[model samples]
Target: MAGTGPQVARSPLELLNNQAAAEPPLLVKHAGPVIFSVVGFIAAAGANWATRRPLLSGVHRYVLIVGGSMAAGIYVEKKRAEHLATRDAMFRHYIELHPEDFPPYERKQFKDLFQEWIPIR
Candidate 1:
């Protein structure tokens, strides 16, 4: 919504009240892990309070925040990678089985005008 179109940017009133596209910044694997870390932080805080281990004030808190964020992000990334690999393999198999259906791919006549037109630049 913030960076959608020029109309929003052009309006002085809307521009003044616009919020950033990304909240909490893009520090850890985009903004996804940040949300996961928040949930983990809450759970860890509750556990820490209940146990009363008598450790440093916030040492465990900070550690859990980072560790939880990484754990969630890595798990999700791994799952996505596996799904993509499976889908790619299926497509390759289909292409091999029906080569006649898919004709030879021809290169576009003018791939990009800038490369040929603007040789000096």
Candidate 2:
């Protein structure tokens, strides 16, 4: 039964725990937000300056930008994973309802076909 299903893709943690998969680097994973981050940097800098906040505007901008990027990246990845997991589960159900509908023609369980996959928006 080890290879009977679609491979669940091994992540570092998955590999360690023997479960599901790996993830892209934060920069790569959250690249989409780079623009937003730039905008936010501008905004944070503005706020810092307008309020004359104790923190330096430049430092504040970088901190907010970096922190926001990392947070957004992690959040996006988590949501993506959850979405993928849900889709996979649905696929699994479909496989159950009509196994013949999928390929490999001889796959037993529904987890196989998934050695790895690219996440999409």
Top-TM-score candidate index: 1
What value of lDDT does candidate 2 attain over all alpha carbons? 0.62
lDDT of 1 at 34: 64
lDDT per residue (tens digit) for residues 30-86 in model 2: 675665566666767777778887545478567867679757766776788799878
- Ten residues in a row with the worst lDDT in model 1? 7-16
As for candidate 2, its clashing pairs are: 5-112, 6-111, 6-112, 6-113, 7-112, 10-21, 11-21, 11-22
Query: What is the Cα-based lDDT of residue 116 in candidate 2?
Result: 70
lDDT of every model, 2 decimals: 0.62, 0.62
* Structural similarity to truth (TM-score) of each candidate: 0.44, 0.42
lDDT of 2 at 19: 46
Cα RMSD for candidates in order:
17.3, 12.9
After superposition, which runs of candidate 1 have C-alpha atoms over 4 Å from their true positions?
1-57, 111-121
